[model samples]
Target: MSSMAERRHGISTPAASTQLKLRFIDRDEHVYFWFPLLAGLSELTFDPRQEIRHSALEVLFDILRFHGGSFAQSFWVRIFDSVLLPIFDHVRAEVTDTTTFTSEKRRQQEEQWLYETCTRCLQHLVDLFVQFYDEAFTLLSRLLDLLRGFMNRSHQSLAAVGVAAFVRLAVKAGPIMNETCWEEVIAALLAILEETAPEARDLITPPPRLNPAVAAAVATAVATAAAPISTSVSSAISSEITPASGSGSPSGGPSAHHPPTAPSGAAMANGGGGAAPVGAGGRTFTLREGVGARRLAKFRCQAATQLLLVQGCSEIYANASQSLPPGAVRGLLDALAFIHRHAHAADMDMDLRRRLAVQQ
Candidate 1:
């Protein structure tokens, strides 16, 4: 009677069908569907079209979110080798050009998008399988190598972004990172600061140019005003002009009118009359001699901030710090001091000043 009732309702056959479906999924047959999709996505990473690349990364992110944890270390290594290595190589090649032409600029924009996408995906994987990180030294070394390449590139914008990515990784993985890896990270950062320091010279102020029309008007007004001077005043002016003409002209040649050049050496010295001159408006404009120094100092401060944050969150940081070379610790302290000095010397933002103070 029960068998007849089950047949009538169609329950027994449907239950068997559902069980078969479950068995297929449990047997890992689902990989057949996902493997092809992932492979296609990985290939799409090399597509010249920006939208295709973006879509591929987005789909990959979704797939990773669902299956990243289930993958073995060997599988992860394969993914890194086959998928991520190509993308990183593409980015490195793109940034290497350093050209600012329209097409190159467009290409750079695309490369930046790809780089950021890869970074996010890497971060997600690192966060998802935190335990795998300790044993994934090879993976970390590859990432650092990529970042180092970016840092050494001629493009300041690209290099800066690379430094930022390095900082993010250091902060995220500081507690788990081995001492040797941490040292390498620090060395890379310091190298970036040193490399960028020379670029600060490009930021130096150029000599100011006088407007021709304004200069003509001023000259006419001065001539008209000087014509009516008394004989005594004229003699006094001649007396004052004689010495200047003598100093400007050798062998009693005609006095040449030359635009003033920016002073060097003694004129730029720190104290007395050598100090940077104040303008009529009471603003003092000083030449930027240490722009790179300031930038490096800021970089150090950022690193210190990350270290402090990691220390606050995990006891492993204490152990890691103890393992760090003494010079590295001293370098970090110097960076903090540099930030403090600059904050006090410049008209820095109050909020930033407060934050630095608190960090101190």
Candidate 2:
């Protein structure tokens, strides 16, 4: 009766199936109706279409849940190799081109989707290992390698997510992570924080101001020195002006032309410029549109990434301070101190600065 019920639900009961089909879902014998029907799902998980790929992952998760530890160890290993590792590679490839999206909103949406998907994948993988802690311990070193790859990404959003995920795993693994693993984790986190630290001038410095008297005197002197140069430039332009097709000069003599001129003061100050000043090597320098805004955005992103790192570092320290060796604790403290000096110098949000301060 039990065997009949198991067969009805399509469960692979050992009683009604050969040992080979019952253990390895990949077995050819399982292609028939009585099997668990997982054929081609692994291939589908790597489909080029996003919807298909997502659906396949969802189905795999469901299958894992339904099996309730009934699957063979080899089956789990196969999932790790084919499904989990490949999904991670796919995610990295997708995220590498995230900035290529022309629209800000679209880029943000895609990043958010990737973050959620990556988080879900990490959570599921870690939870699986946590369930069989003793047996799965060896596999987690590879998982740490994956986490390190994510944390090392140049994309700020993905890096933050990686740091958060790594911190969670580190805390969960606790003493399970050997000394070398713990050292590597701390080293990686500190390197990221150091790389992302904001420059002091960009954050903390104010623009210089000039007195009214000094400004007025400077302007008068510049205008006086520039008057003759301006006249010479106008003469040069009139001589060089050429007729455009049939639109000859009204008077047919260089059209009495005067090309647009730079401000007299600036032209003379910049050493005989007709339009604008040129830098060394005759290269013109122009401020790009929205450069300040772009720089500010970049600064904010770096700050945010650093904030995540700091928080993760603090969490790791809190979790393992007692258990960590004295040398490890000293290294963490040095990293934290370095961050404290640099972060306080940067003009970050008061609340975040205070959090760092308090954590220190």
TM-score of 1: 0.44
**Which sections of candidate 2 miss by over 4 Å?**
1-55, 62-81, 198-299, 319-328, 344-360
lDDT of 1: 0.49
lDDT of each: 0.49, 0.57
Candidate 1, residues 100-215: lDDT per residue as tens digits?
A: 33486676776566566656655554554344563355677667777666555554445555555655676667666666766776665555444433221111221222345444
RMSD each, Å: 19.2, 18.7
lDDT, candidate 1, at 209: 27
Top candidate when judged by lDDT against the true structure: 2
Residue 335 of model 2 has an lDDT of 75
What is the lDDT for 274 in model 2? 23
Q: Pick the candidate with the highest TM-score.
A: 2
